[model samples]
Every structure is written in C-alpha cells, then in structure tokens.
Target: MIPGMFDYFAPSTLEEATRLLEQHGPDAKLLAGGHSLIPLMKLRLAAPRVLVDLNGVAGLAGIEERDGHLRIGAMTRHAQLEASELISDRYPLIADAAAVIADPLVRNRGTIGGSLAHADPAGDLASVMTALRAELVVVGPRRERTIPIDDFLVGLFTTALEPNEVLSEVRVPSPNGGSGGAYVKLERKVGDFATVAIAVQLTVRDGTCDEAGIALTSVGPTNLRARQAEDSLRGGSLDEQSLRAAADLAAQEAQPAADLRGSEEYKRDMVRVLTLRALRRALERATR
Candidate 1:
C-alpha cells in the first residue's frame, strides 16, 4: 500500500536534523531505518506531514566500547548486532534476541533506535535492554540527555522522548566478569511475536547468586521489570526450588490480555515456565 503525500527531508548533519525537527514539531516523524514507521504509514495509522529521514546522519551507525560499556549507535541494524563479535562475546543475550527479531530480511534493515523508539510491548529488544539496564541517549533542541531503559519506555507505542528529540545512542553497562545473560521466548511460530518472552542476567559468585536482572515482554502495557523475582534470587542459590519461587512471583505481576497468543491464564503460566527456563540457562552461562 502507498502512503499519503508527505514532504521528506534528509539532513546530512545532526544539527540540521534537530533544527528541522524543532521547526516541524509533532507533525514530523523521524525516519530511521523505516521498517516500523513505514508499515504504520502504509496502514494510515500514522500520517505525519513531514518525514525527517535520519539515514543521512553519519555518526549514528556503529557499535564501539566506550567508558567500560558498549555504546551502540541508534542506527545500527539488528543483523549487525547479531553478527558482531563484541555482542556475541560480551552480551549473548543481545545477540540471541537480535538473531530472532522478525526474520532475516527484517533484521537486515531494522535499526536498533527505531525498535527502541517504537516501544512495542512485544519487541524482544525492549525487554532485553530492560534486563541489561541499558540507557538511551536522546538529542533534542538544546541538549542531549540519557534515560534509563525502563524510564525511556513509558507505555505501549509511546516513549519519554519529546517530539523534537532523536535517539542517538544506546549505552549498555558491561556485565561483571562472572556474569552472563539469556533471553527465552515462546513464539507461536518461527517468525511470530512471542506469546511470552523473558530476559535474564545473572551474576553468580562462589556458589551464590550475586545479582539478577529479570524482565518480561508482551504481558503488560510496557516491558516490565521482574523486581520481586530479581530480589528473590539475590544472595540465594539459584536451584530448582528457588527458581520456582521466583517464577511464581514474576507470574503474579503479569497483566496479560486474552488474545490469539493464548488465554490470559495460559500466558501467566508460560511466564512462570519461561522465567524459570531463562534463569537456569543464564545461571549456567554465568557460572561457567
């Protein structure tokens, strides 16, 4: 389907882009690897008068280690992350989610910033970023500010970014030397959105759980932190019984709606199952 008539601007510089955005305000939409926005435009679900294409901006497309963290450019594609040695070696959880996002073709073109800005409750990256404690760097008219992952995403299809802001980078804190992470998802089919998705990061030391980061996707209005579950595992052995107890607490926080994915009750149960599975695998990787 063709989109409605709209003016397009591809500014080669960041300053120029921000000025354009400030001029156009809410009527303008930033187009960054347009896999998400293009579909919405085709459906007429989004009808912005101006499309400010970010492709021309040079600095927004790479991954590098900076200040003891992985600083990923907002424009980096999912396929890039999936194949990156930096991600595979240090953050397998990110690689796992990136490899399974949409499909090969979609991953080839989908940008990290676009997905994060899209803020779809079911997207794999949002939940993974939450568990990883990632921070979003957004640039606006007067200044650039960093927002933590959980604070950046406010609700479904919404974010804390103002209309004139551009997400420039995503900074993920480096995991401790003995820590590891995992992502587990239950999709109806190979390419479908997850029925229940779980992301976990565990830091184990001397046969005890040091820290845990747990998050849920597709079961609420936003990507949710499993704080209760995380707290339960801290300072305890991550054995079967402890995992079961944490999973139960995580499941209790779910507010899923009945849909084609499954009944509400069914998804809640899967939350328990997947949470346990994700934590176990995460612990194995960390302990090795």
Candidate 2:
C-alpha cells in the first residue's frame, strides 16, 4: 500500500516540530514510529497534506526512574520497553504489554506515544495507562500541561491534544510494597490486535486489597476504566468469590462491539476471564 504524496518535514527538535505543526495545523500529521499513521495513510483513511516526522527529534527516547516515578520519553520503542530491566522490575504491566504489542520487527518500530495518541480502542497501552492512573506531558507552541490518562483519551482515534501539541513524556508512580500489576490479552494471531484484553494493578496489605485498578481494551468506544469492578475489589480478601464478582462487574461495564473476532457476548465473557486471570497474576507478583 502507498500513501498519498505529501510534504515531509523531519524536524530534529521538538520546538521545530511544534512550529511545523502550528504552521500546518490540521493538515499535518506527526510521525513517530509511523506504525499507526502510515497504515491509516496507506488505507486512505487518513490524508494529511503535510507529514511532520518526529523520528529525528532527539531526547524523546529512553526510560528513567526519578522522583519516585518512572518517566518515559514518548519516542521510546516497544522493544526498548520490553528489554528494559528497570521497566521489568518497576512496571511489569508495561513490559508485559510491550512484549506482545506485535512481532519483533513491529515492536522495534512501534512507539508508545504514537499508540497512545492514535487512541485506538483495541490498543493495549491506553487501558494499561488508565489502570495505572498514568499522566502524559503534552507540549504545544503556547504552553505545556499534564493530562491524566482518563482525560487524555476521549474516543476512538481521538485525544485531548491540540493539533499543535506533542506528547513528550509518560509518567508512572513507583509501586509500593504489595503492589503488583500485569496485562493479559487475547488475540487471534501473533500480531493481531487484541480481541479482548485487560490490564490490572492491585495493591494488597494483610491479605486484603489496599488499592485496585482495572481497565478493559476493545470493549467500548474507547478503552475504559472498570471503576465499579475496581471498587468491588477494594478492602476485600482477594478470594475466589471476590475475584469472580469483580470480574463479572468488569464484563457488565464493557460495551464490546461484535466483529470477526467474536460476538459481543463472547467478548464480554473473555473480559471476565481475562480480568480474573490478570488480577490473579498481578496478585501472585505482589510485593511485600
């Protein structure tokens, strides 16, 4: 597939990128890993007249833990996240999703910022970010601001970012003792998007849930937090019945669409099953 002819600009600095975007406005698309934009462009589903490539923009890749939070540059690739010892040790939920984002080649080329900004409902990272209550730092020509994951994701292929803004960084808090997180996905093939997936972060203390975060993927117009399910798990001993109840609530909150993957009911069922599995796995990895 080939994309339409367009003017290409590979800006080496963020300020330059922003300037290009501000100048081009809605006619321009920022190219990160090019995984999402390129595909859409090739399909003619997107036709930006200007391509503002961010690939050459330095200082937008890497993972660093600082000030009790792990800060990830937007240009960081999935392969890097999957290979990072620091990410594996501190935020396995990220590493877990990174490992399965696509095959090795795709993983090497996919960037977290691109995926998040694309805001595909079926993508795994949005749910994981929501589950962790992560924040994104967005920069524009006028100002900079932080957006919570829930607020950042508005709908399918939509976000709060202005056309002139760029997502610069992702920030996640350090997990305390007894805190554990994991992501579980069900895909039809090795590189397919998830049919139904779940991301969970749970904190336990004295055999009871101290905190819980649950989010579902490919289950609604946008990836969403399962707040009722999360509330159901809090202050309870994570036993068979409690887990089942919480998992069931997650399914109830889901609004999955029927596609070739399966029926809506089947997807809801998968949500229940995967939610339970993810919670169990996260619990087993719980620290303290």
Best by lDDT: 2
What is the model-wide C-alpha lDDT for candidate 2? 0.93
Clashes of 1: 0
Q: In model 1, which range of ten residues has the least summed lDDT?
A: 173-182
Question: All predictions: root-mean-square deviation over Cα?
Answer: 1.0, 1.0
Encode model 1's per-residue lDDT on 1-288: one tens digit a residue: 889999999999788889999999999999988888999999999999999999999899999987888999999999999999989999989988998888888898899999999999998999999998999999998999999998899998999999989999999998868889999999988877889999999888888988889999999998899999999999999888998999999999887899998999999999999999998888888988
Each prediction's TM-score versus the true structure: 0.98, 0.98
Q: Tell me which residue pairs clash in candidate 2.
A: 178-287
TM-score of 1: 0.98
Where does model 2 exceed 4 Å of error?
Answer: none
Superposed by TM-score, candidate 1 places the C-alpha of residue 251 at a distance from the truth, in angstroms, of 1.0
Model 1 stretches with alpha carbons more than 4 Å out: none
